[model samples]
Target: MHRFKILFVCMGNICRSPLAEGIFKHMTDNAARAGEFEIDSAGTGGWHQGNPPDPRSVAVAAAHGVDISTQRARRIAVGDFDRFDLILALDRDILRNLRKIVPAGETDKLQLFSRYARGIDEDIPDPYYGGREDFDRVYTMLLTGCTSLLDTAGKLRTS
Candidate 1:
């Protein structure tokens, strides 16, 4: 069984990407597909490396029954381009940054995290500077996007 490797990206690993990683991991685990996927999160910048997800992000995920507090922040690395089958960026700017550093011939692996989301066609908003409401909103958006992303991954596997 070849597991599909996925890495979520945001400005800092302490927020959105970590949330997405946790949410997606929870979804897959609940579905009994956890062994079929490799999920992780990274930031475009190195500022947050070695730290945990922002307190708000941890609290938001916990409120929704997922625990992301154990996950540590890390910066995107050159090897990640070869390691992950898919690299999902939380926003356009992050996506652009990933594109810039992606090795040639690996562009196809990069995509916006919202690509499979039902009604959202843009980046997932950064909620770092906002309040609890912003974190809640981001959690909702990630739930929807992660669900659709799993569906997309399933389809790709079968194809």
Candidate 2:
């Protein structure tokens, strides 16, 4: 089997995107062989560049027994277009922004994160300025989406 690289994207790397990255990584790690898939995330902008995932975001993920304390904020770069097999955006705006940067040949690799969600209409909401509940809600939403994503990616990997 071949290893596939996935990049999660959002307004900032500190919130939704990192949560998705952490959740997806955990699911994939427990499902497939040691190196079947890789997950990472970055922001559309560099506002939080060099920062760690938000305190609430880390706390929420840790509460669920997932550690996302090591994630650092980064802005999406041109090289990321080539590095990741999938460039997943948290919302329509980020998807649109990604579309502008991805070349024609690679556009198919870019997508809305909800495409992997099983039965949800809402994308993961950013929890930068909200309360702890917001982070908790995003944690749940991404848990569903990332698990679904891992299922699909794992299937593609096995078959």
Candidate 3:
């Protein structure tokens, strides 16, 4: 009955991380596995804390039948290291930032999100300053990665 907790992180919670949180939630709900997961998103910096996700991220997620408008931005916290079973970073830089702050014994919780993706091995680029095409590209990558992550959750559960 334990829920598998996950936290998606980015430089700012407005763009990439929020999108990832929404998409993963949508996927889990669609599969009727929503009850088995606890999902959320955060940023490395608190500049946008308490603000909603960027409009572009909301629009793109809406276009894909997911709504991320209700999510609020928040900076990653030390408590999060203990809260989530997995802490996924959108890029290598974020991964490094996470490594620096993660508690010594909790280091295993940090990971690069793309590792779950089937073919993609690169960092997920920040699309905050770009146009719709940029958001679209990030959406595609997240969809693929989230699907893989869900597929692998059984292993996480067993472990």
Residue 33, model 1, lDDT: 90
Better of 1 and 2 by lDDT: 1
Q: What's the CA error at residue 19 for candidate 3, in Å?
A: 0.5
Cα-based TM-score, every candidate: 0.96, 0.92, 0.96
Candidate 3 per-residue C-alpha lDDT over 81-139 given as tens digits, one digit per residue, 9 for 90 to 100: 99999999999999999998998899988889997555566899999889999999999
Candidate 1 residue lDDT tens string, 106-135: 999998888644546688999999999999
Show pairs that collide, candidate 3: none
lDDT agreement with native, every candidate: 0.91, 0.84, 0.92
lDDT of 2 by residue, 14-65 (tens): 8899888888877766765438887789999999999999989899989987
- Residue 26 lDDT in candidate 2: 75
Model 1 Cα displacement at 108 (Å)?
0.2
